[model samples]
Target: MFAPFAPMLRRAALVPSVHRLLPSNSRSLYQNIIKRHEDMATEHGSPSSSGEMHDALDVLSSESSPISTIPLDPDTDYAALAIPSLQSKNKANLPPLMNIPPQEDPLLHHIASRIMNHGERAKASRTVSQMLLHLHAWTRSPPLPILRQAIFKLSPAVKVIGHKHSTKMIYKPVPLSEKQGIWLATEWILDAIKGRQGGPTLAERMAREVILILKNESKTLEKKEAYHKSAMMNRGNIAIART
Candidate 1:
């Protein structure tokens, strides 16, 4: 008798949970709930596998991006125009990395620092190194000796100064200290480099000029001569110049 009553006992235990899910229902309401559950079971049979989920995602991605492409011109990049950095190709195709720089000599460092502008010291250092390499190639000898010789030959002894004398500017020949002389030499050399008509880079132009300086053919030499002549002509004003 107990065995026969087991199914009825289980059904009676579920009655409370079914009642909680539905309003106080008659026989027809219970039948409708069962029919709805059966329909739902048929509609959504089982959970999706990982492969099925991935396929769905891939299909969605393909549909959303059927013709993906990147624009060559940044001006036409409508996507990231608002961002300042990406607005221009400022991050594109930079120059190759510079070779080992000549930084052992303090004099060389000082010259490199002068060559550097706008805080870009790396380029200056590389240019200085290139100058050495060029010197070596031209003379078929150690570069340092030639470099020192050029600097010594190119360095000027005196700099011209002007004094206000009775509504006239009187030029004075002022002897430059070692420091002043080196700085002035560097300035003049750089100025000459800038004035050169042809050369892709400062290093090449400067190297060519240094080689010419060695050969006594550079405009830097001419400039030095002009300064000396001016100083000689204005030697009278030397008395007025500060001691």
Candidate 2:
């Protein structure tokens, strides 16, 4: 009986009671918290923990899917799988091109060609351009119209050419066609300008002649009148000059 009582006392001293370490109210509160934890654990374990974990993994995989399975936002995108672009549709609104070239005046081109010395066409073009610019400076209006007026005033209705009137050749005036009249007028202008004195450049000479013709005092006009006189007197030879 003594041995049993000594062993029982030793055991009771080794183990401490919860009531001694904590107040009665604290001990009751602690018990209530532990009971709530145990009930929650049992409820969660009853519904298969592994099954819930697998369901969560499936949800994550669906959110990160390679193929889209949701409708696109109407404002932000046209379609879910389609690329966004309008490169071709916007281009249709632009104006169409005809691919036509720019054209210069025919008389201007012809004059430039006639002025060309050797194969230096670029130089001749510069000279002609300078001449036109000078005309522009003197007159406030466009130069080409004034130039055409001068050409019309100076171009004779007939040209004198030598024709055989028996064994000897006699000079006779013949009626000139429209094209020939233009050519003869331009030639007279060029010839008159070429024979000038005290002009520094060919462009200046040509400009001065053009201006004089506009004022009705150019040498070209005189030559034109002289030709008309001879043509009038030689009208008798018109029949012979036709051949």
Best by TM-score: 2
Per-residue lDDT tens digits for candidate 1, residues 112-182, read: 99988899888888888988887778779988777777887878899798878899988789887877777
The RMSD of every model to the true structure, in order and in angstroms, is: 25.0, 29.2
**Clash list (residue pairs), candidate 2:** none
Q: What is the lDDT of residue 4 in candidate 1?
A: 93
User: Residue 60's C-alpha lDDT in candidate 1?
Assistant: 37
What lDDT does candidate 1 reach at residue 125?
88
Off by over 4 Å in 2: 1-102, 168-171, 195-199, 240-243
The C-alpha local distance difference test score for the whole of candidate 2 amounts to: 0.74
Error of 1 at 227 (Å): 0.8
Best by lDDT: 2
